[model samples]
Target: MTFVHWLAGQAGQTFASACVMTILVLMLFMAMKLYKSYRRNQTHLVLIIVLPLIIIQNGVLISLSDPEWSASPYLHIGYSFVSLLSFIIINFVFMKLYTGPASRLKGMPFFLMAIGLVVVTAAQIAYKPEMLSGPIAPGGVDLLALDFYGLILNFIILLNLRGVDQRINYQTSLIVYFVYQLSDMADSYVFHGEKPMLLIFIHLLPIVYYTLLFLLLFEWVLERLMMTFQSSITDGLTSLYNRRHFNKKAEQLLRDMKRIAIIFCDIDNFKKLNDTQGHHKADNVLKQVAEIIKEETAGIGTAGRYGGEELLGLIAAPGVKPEDVAEAIRSRVEKETMVTISVGVSISREGTSIAEIVSQADEAMYQSKTTGKNKVTLHPSVSQKRPRSESEGSKRSKQA
Candidate 1:
């Protein structure tokens, strides 16, 4: 064969291979996702398993058919079958991802399918079948009917692009599928039997389409896993690290540090505030205080909600005073939220247990509560017994 003829044959085989590979890869991902959802008891996502099956069936049928049969009546029947399956998949995805009137349009697919089948059948009977046996000629009824079905399917798929849940992976998959179909349709009319280079490139488009689908699926899966991890470690109300995550991280920090500071803070008269202002208002106060603590601890330590109306912070660094941080937090809470917090700070060196440090801080904080609200107190071991004015001057200097 001439090189040109050889290249054409290779291109055709490559197109078939691309379709087969795409089907295999899609099926693998769908199976993995299905298995994961099944293990999680998320049966709602199990229906997605059927989508890859539809694509696989379509690919297999297309690979088996000859290019010359592209517009033939039998080929039209194959296309109709694929279109119907696509409609089924689209309807399922729309209902699963969206709600309201659009989701209620479930029966529309069946209605359209029935009308399409009747119209295609009549068109095939009325027109000469021989005239439809090539790349979609202008007036060929078979190709027209197929094109009409494609347009309607694309319209339905496009509707799904709006107002659907942002987290749904199938959204990107459907978009890729729609673009693939549109490219196929464009190639049929615009590049049919064209230059060798253009034809080869056109045939290779499916490989790109399927590869994008795989990447989008991988991205979706990774995002979900990250979100799950974040939710587990974070406080839902204040977005601070929860107590469990805080302790786990603090233990790691303590092991690596020579000097560590632990600060325990509690809102004064918090129960009275909740009773007078309601739990909703109390929650707002907690959130505001958490934000202030987080801001104050930024770059110096990690802060978290230890329990109701209480927060804990860990600072591990040389030449940094824990008392300064406690005072900073106290002042910010008072200034920003018009509320008072009693803060207790403890500095630990070698041979100090996490529990011991926390206990010291808690004890000092209680001392502040007893003495007066909105004051910072250091553990007796760390306190220098400086005059009150000098200590206040030192705190102001450190804050500056």
Candidate 2:
């Protein structure tokens, strides 16, 4: 068989492989997202997988097609421009959506500069459609322009990866794009040379790139897996560690046999806040409350989203008393949320279990809740009285 025929066959196979891997990986991610029951960001992940499939498939088609200058060169050029532009634009949107708007500042300029490269490539294709049929001389303007354009695009892909927060995603994308560019350059050269080994090498190029892409995709799957695991132990709306992690950590703290303090806090009339401001505003308020809680107890203590409208923090400081931590948090939360927190504290002496400590803490919380609100309650041993009147308790619950 001719070199061109062999190389073309390899290109076709590479494109097919990439398509297969993309479909499989995307389906796997979709399954993960569904299993985890996360409602947000699933669509974004789908777009990320689908957009590349389009670009890679188009590339393979262009590589295999025979060029005819007399035919609609303009149409082919337009198609090329659309393909490249679409890939870049979709990638930009994906980056921004996932990483936030600030990340776009760094990537948008790079993409804007790429506009010139796209224009040049399209112009080249339209002016000389025959160049599209086969590889160009390395030293020629057409090849030079295309190579330069590729360099810019590759650089932008890398730069965008760098700005992302997800470490595995960034590294995997970098590796995949790096190998892909290498295979792309090698394919160009093999097309020109047409040697027997080069034909085989050309066929193998897509396999390498596709394999790397698949690996990157698996990294994404792994990341999503990690996120799902993390979410189970985290508050869905506020992103703080959930009650499960809190309970586990509290148990560990108990086993350490050190004097530990537990603080239970309830957002004062959060139901009223939700009713007055609407759920969206209430969500923002919850996030703000979580942030303040996280900021305050960050290194010294462990905070957990103890179900709705409540949070728990465990401070393992033998020197600090339960009342002090409760007071500090209550004051700060009141200031930030413009709403009070009825805080309850329970301190466990050495050798106490987490369940016992929690039971004591919860009883204290109920006391605070019954006695109006906004006030702090200490463990029965530390404070005067525990129970409040049933009528008062019923009234407070009704008001809330």
Candidate that would win on lDDT: 1
lDDT of 2: 0.62
Q: Deviation in angstroms for 167 in model 2?
A: 12
Model 1 lDDT tens row, 154-174: 566656545444525555555
Q: Write the per-residue lDDT of candidate 2 for residues 189-274, one digit (tens) a residue.
A: 54553444554554455455445445544555677679778887888898888877888887776677466778887887899989
Residue 290's C-alpha lDDT in candidate 1?
91
Model 1 has an lDDT value of 0.66
Q: Give the runs in model 2 whose Cα sits over 4 Å from its true position.
A: 1-215, 383-400
Model 1, which residues run further than 4 Å from truth? Answer: 1-47, 65-72, 87-141, 155-160, 164-183, 186-191, 384-400
Candidate 1: lDDT of 334? 73
- What would the TM-scores of all predictions be? 0.76, 0.53
Clashes of 2: 0
